[model samples]
Target: MQAVMKNVDCIIEVHDSRIPFSGRNSEFEYTIGGRPKILILNKADLADMSCRKQVVDKLKRDGCSRVLFSDCKHDSTNIIKKILPSIQELIHDAGRYHRAENRDYNVLVCGVPNVGKSSLTNAIRHKYLRAGKATQVGPTAGVTRSVLEKIRVCDEPLTYILDTPGVLAPNVRNVEVGMKLALCATLQDHLVGETIIADYLLYWMNRHRRFEYVEHFGLKEPTDNITELLVPIAIHSNKIQKIRTSEGRYEYKPNISQAARVVMAAFRTGKLGKFMLDDDALDSLSEPAVADNAGDARHRS
Candidate 1:
């Protein structure tokens, strides 16, 4: 990524809007070195849009001024319409430096995994070239293993995008932050147990008073017990397994793993409800940083 940044005109960092204030790779600042950077908080449809302005304002105060909320998968037109103009504006404002004579633009699309980096790349290509998918899009993390060849995404400004694999910080600040990353699907599900993620999701929802999951999943009411939630979900979805009993009879057992996955998928697909998972962190925007961890990165693994 460092080598590629040398030739890149601008950097477009895509991130999960659900956890906008967390999980972004902080190393990029040193790698890109003063080049124009645009933060695209993708998955806007799955995030609580009511807090959109607050999120943008918080990010800008944290030195990320060019933040744009995007739902690349569901609504591409809105972002595609603003992306090029934003890119041009940033590029010109930054004076283009060595690339001033170069009429074409090369943008590096990067972020932690499963945050719609490829989706954004494909969205731009579709809007400009009217073409199909240029890079593979997947729900799992690390789908794009390495930096890919540049592909033209626009004709007017001769814009091209370089799709790169997601890079996560080596360590997270705490367990809850890790859970947030896991819930956002930036980290592999197995790395953090599915049920654990579901529990965290439940805790988060209950903490935020987000009860849409209960109504959507047909639960009687909100509960902290992971099993209590998954048992009903599994039974309703028929996600159960048959086990041979001692007397040769069969017993139906809820597939908790599968049920946990169902819950995770529901949140990812916006079935549970939209969320601004970092709402709590926004409160610290005005507070001074902790002394001991002054340089500690907020980015998650």
Candidate 2:
């Protein structure tokens, strides 16, 4: 990442809108210091939009002056329209040094895994260049394995973007944050265990009193025990497996793993309901001193 930092005129960091505050890699802030940066909260369509303004206001207070909500799956988003203009303004304010004589601009696109970095890149390319996809995109994380050469997305201003692989922080702040990342598919599900992720989802939903999952999964009532909850879903969905017993007899059992995957898929695809996992974090932003202190600690680290 440092190798191309000097060449970048602007940096666009993409992150999951559902986890606005929990799983961001603060290391990028230090790496892209002094460079014009924009925070694109991708997958806005899947996030709870009731507190959208509050999220934007909180981000600005935390020094992210330019925050845009975007849904890269769509052909056109207002945020996509504003990106080029915003970058142009930033470049004009902070004149390029190495490429001062050059008319074209190079911007670096980066973020953690599964945050729609490549999707956003392709969306921009389609919007500006009227071109096909320039970068590969996938449902799982870490699709772009390495930084690639510049891909032109615009012609009038000759704008190109350097696509980089998703890089996560070395250490997640806490177990809850790690689970949140896993829930969003930012982290590989196998690494964290499917059942564990499902458990966290249940815990978070119950904590917030969001019982949409009960109706979505056809459960009569909510239950804290993951096994009990998953058994009903497994039966409802006919996700059953046959197992051999020690006595050489076969028995039918609930496919808990399959049921867990179903639950996780519902959460990710918003079948359960739109939610902001960082809602509690945003609420805490009301206290200025607490937010300031947390921001300072992240910068220092």
Candidate that would win on TM-score: 2
Model 1: per-residue Cα lDDT over 126-212, one tens digit each: 988899999988889889875565879999878999998886452367898899999998899999999999999999889778899
Best candidate according to lDDT: 2
Pairs that collide in candidate 1 are: none
Per-residue lDDT of 231 in model 1: 94
Candidate 2: the clashing residue pairs are none
* Ten contiguous residues with the weakest lDDT in model 2: 282-291
Clashes of each: 0, 0
For model 2, what is the error of residue 109's alpha carbon versus the real structure, in angstroms, after optimal superposition? 0.5
Candidate 2 residues 226-266, lDDT tens each?
99889988998999999999999999999998999999999
Candidate 1 weakest ten by summed lDDT: 292-301
TM-score of 2: 0.91
lDDT of model 2 at position 139: 89
Which residue segments of model 2 deviate by more than 4 Å?
Answer: 75-77, 287-301
